[model samples]
Target chain A: MAKQDRAIRTRQTILEAAAVVFERQGYQAATITEILKVAGVTKGALYFHFESKEELALGVFDAQEPPEQVPPQPLKLQELVDTGLWFIHRLRTNLLTRAGVRLSMDQQAHTLDRRGPFLRWREMLLSLLDQARENGELLPHVDTSESADLIMGAFTGIQMVSQTLSDYADLEERYISMQRHVLPSLAVPSVLAALDLSPGRTERITAELAAVQD
Target chain B: MAKQDRAIRTRQTILEAAAVVFERQGYQAATITEILKVAGVTKGALYFHFESKEELALGVFDAQEPPEQVPPQPLKLQELVDTGLWFIHRLRTNLLTRAGVRLSMDQQAHTLDRRGPFLRWREMLLSLLDQARENGELLPHVDTSESADLIMGAFTGIQMVSQTLSDYADLEERYISMQRHVLPSLAVPSVLAALDLSPGRTERITAELAAVQD
Candidate 1:
């Protein structure tokens, strides 16, 4: 049991180090030598975990989705908002999330299939929007799949622009503005009125999640 | 004049070949050797025109913005729509624009500055929105800069998503949906009623521009 735990820990350590290098140097510019050096792991051990750089990038791309779900809200629209806000918060605080998103959105990373994350995000958002429609939170004209696509695409672009401009320092602010603009198009006015789209809400939710985890 | 014309043609040939390779293999993976082979040009000739692969990619990136204007509209909101639709049309028809946009949005292309395209698009949109506001086309609650940012980012994301999903086969449809959702937030009812956000508009504008050029 102890040996198994050690192997798992080592894998996590290597993944983390790979994320840092990939984030800094991008996919093509990043080298396994740098990742190995940063990870401080022997060739045999690193190879045991990941076969190649493509596999490492795929690993990092898979980790963008948070392990824990946000606490549910009465309004499905609010749940969607929470999900987006939580991601923005993680993007600001976690290197793993940032790196995963970077790799997923990197059009130049030709070897690895980057579409998985985008399709997964669309599925998650579509499910939430379907629930919102059932709960009568959405505008009558809203289509769940289309809304999902817009939200996913808009979030991807907004975060990208923020990263380019301020390295994500203004990501939360940009996200808030995005929600204010897009929510009206997706949700009814009454539903929009009750939802919290503030930057402080991200902090509060992060605190709550930490408390629960503890 | 004949010598200058030949030189210009050679330069254009090199740029077009570079764009094809860059579009297919991306910036990092593309090579000058491959570009030269494709261009049927000697190394000396290629070097004479461009200093390096980086400069080649920049040249491609700079060519994304069309050299000609879309011909002004009476309502600037219509002008904004036309600009976007025209870009969507070009992204479909022009390999140079595709390669340029691929480089500009390639987050993995770490050497070249990618912000120029995004910022330029934002500046263009903001200028048009300012005009729309002056024409009483925008809603009173709309902030032009925020609207510009949202429009630019959303367009970026929408096209990217389309590119990933269908290789831009459904881009015009997705772009029309985006304008539908976003325009309501920016334009007043009277203005929104008059603007053309249809896929057909792109074809009509292209035809008009071709006739004008001829």
Candidate 2:
């Protein structure tokens, strides 16, 4: 392999291995020896890639980027919001969320009070939320940063809450409910009305949602 | 100690130790050994008092049960719903949410699928929602079980999302947004009128919430 290609391959190997070990034993319990075993890499190779366990953990953390941050253009507003919304819906339904969550907690041990990949994700979300708000896509009263935090927070809460609830429960229904019912608070009534939702999608879903309570 | 007194003391000691460890190390890192040491108890004593870590964790979960759950009550309908809403609101500001999350993740790894304290909280919420539906407090269309799950899920999502976003950020506004805008979908226009909200408690809070959105 060329030198640059070899470096990229090795980096991928270490992260893939670390993800496995972190998933299995958690961050505190997982040893470097085990990661190397999983990755099928030598300790020398591991050291060349990462100086410490924390660095490796961070590398793994960097692998995640929620789909909501995709460039906010060339699509219906619903697609933009729904794409982000849809990822979280799948996040609840998928195994990746479980792995992602396990790995997140594992690395959280060494995490600091501020400044990290976690915060970077926040900045990305707020930037998008602010852009949407300024574009008259959100309510005048909705505090951009806090509302962004709330929207993001609700996604995490739903996944964790799902794990605690019954297995084989519906995730998409929860997402629909949030987008339709819960998220309106962060929106202007005009924005809520203006989002890429057709009267048909809203009417059909809300009708079904309405029937459940009745 | 009398039987009741002994039970009370045992619960007290276990929970007290739990609070310390949970607050300091976060939940996943805290072990029975640590809680025992803080409680000045033996392994035997610890195991005798609580069947498992899950039981102990959930047992101490509610440090913030509101005045209503603890209150002198004629048991107004609004209070019950408000209390449920407030429990979720308290969780955002609650320092223990982080520890609870880490602990929940740790608990999840022990089984391919399982229920945790947070899940039980969801169940409790569903129970409340069911009552609300029966009482005609919610809009006719809202499915109590699904709505409960949806609200619970969003609440969970918001907390982690906030932590990931900022330190000392304005989390309280998230709750206000939920209350003001997001909650309206479940209301029947008639019920909204019927809601003779207490000016003393509900009105003052309502005005404050309206201001946040404005």
Candidate 3:
């Protein structure tokens, strides 16, 4: 049992080291030797745990899988978007996992083959979108597949821009406002009316946010 | 004058070589020696043109500055969005610059300091957004600054995804569909009514697109 625990601990150490090295040097530039050195593991130990660099990278990528799609609640389409946007905002701003989002957009995170993780997120999102649309939650005219692509695409793009210009962290507010405009058009009048999107709603969320002060 | 022209041509040749090197091997990985070799210029010529490797990278980045934004003919908000989405579609399909958008998003673009030629675009877009808001083209509640950032962020996002997944190149249609949802709430009813986004309109555009093969 002690030996098994030690082996598990070593695996975690290697993954942590790999994430840092990948973030710092990017995928193409990083070397296994350096990753091994940082992890304080012997080359034999790393090879035992992961046969190749691709295997290690895939492991790291798997660790940062995107959060599950937010389950639908009875709200305006705009509110759904706002709540999703808010979820990402919190994820990106959280001190414990700010680097989490970077793993998706920053080239530093491009060290691994992205087809797997990216596609998984895409699949999950597409399913959620179809579910939302079928539930009559989507406006009659809004195409959920395309909307999913746009939302995910823009999310990645906005995040990429933030990576390039750190000053654009507040770019999320822009997304929120855009959602307010766009979501209303797709939402039935009833859903649109249900959303309390005034400045007071912002105040309430702000207070809720503040309650979780670091 | 003749000697100066020759020198200018030589300088441009060196910069072009630098771009090729940076794009292929990335910024830190591509060396000055490789650039010189590609330029077929001596070290002295390279030094004369660009003082150092960093300066050479800046030269390459400056070359990427999009041709100045043409003051597009005044159009409705939907039309304005169509113009923007069409640009992204063209970037995806255009043979001359198909890969160029991909280069813009990559890490090498950040080689020479943070702000590159793309900074000019933000200011230009901000002005457009201000104009749209002033003309009552957007919802009264919309913040122009946030709205502009939203459009810009989404543009970057769509382009990023399209580059990686060729299946996403159909973004133009989806972009139009997306605008359909986004615009009605934002634009005045008259402005919204004037825009043609019918299914027939899409078939017509597709026909026109087919004519421009290559």
Q: Specify the highest-lDDT model's number.
A: 1
TM-score of chain A of each: 0.94, 0.73, 0.71
User: What lDDT does candidate 3 reach at residue A131?
Assistant: 67
Candidate 2 lDDT at B76 equals: 32
- Candidate achieving the largest DockQ: 1
Question: Which residue ranges in model 3 land beyond 4 Å of their true spot?
Answer: A1-7, A69-72, A75-112, A171-175, A193-214, B1-11, B69-71, B76-104, B108-111, B167-181, B193-214
lDDT of 3 by residue, B1-214 (tens): 7999999999988877876776666666778999999989999999987998788766665544443332243544644654564455455554223333444565543454645534554555567667777777766776666655666666667666665565455566656655676667666777778776654554454455556543
Candidate 3 per-residue lDDT over residues A52-80, each given as its tens digit: 87777777766555544333355535345
Interface RMSD of each: 1.7, 3.7, 2.9
Regarding lDDT, does 2 or 3 come out ahead? 3
Tens digits of per-residue lDDT, candidate 1, B7-104, equal: 99999899999998987776777899999999999999999999999889878877786334797889998888888888888888888888888887
Error of 2 at A9 (Å): 1.8
DockQ of each: 0.55, 0.39, 0.51
| Pairs with steric clashes in candidate 3 | A27-A111
Question: In model 3, what is the error at residue A191, expressed in angstroms?
Answer: 2.5
Model 1 C-alpha lDDT versus the unseen true structure: 0.84
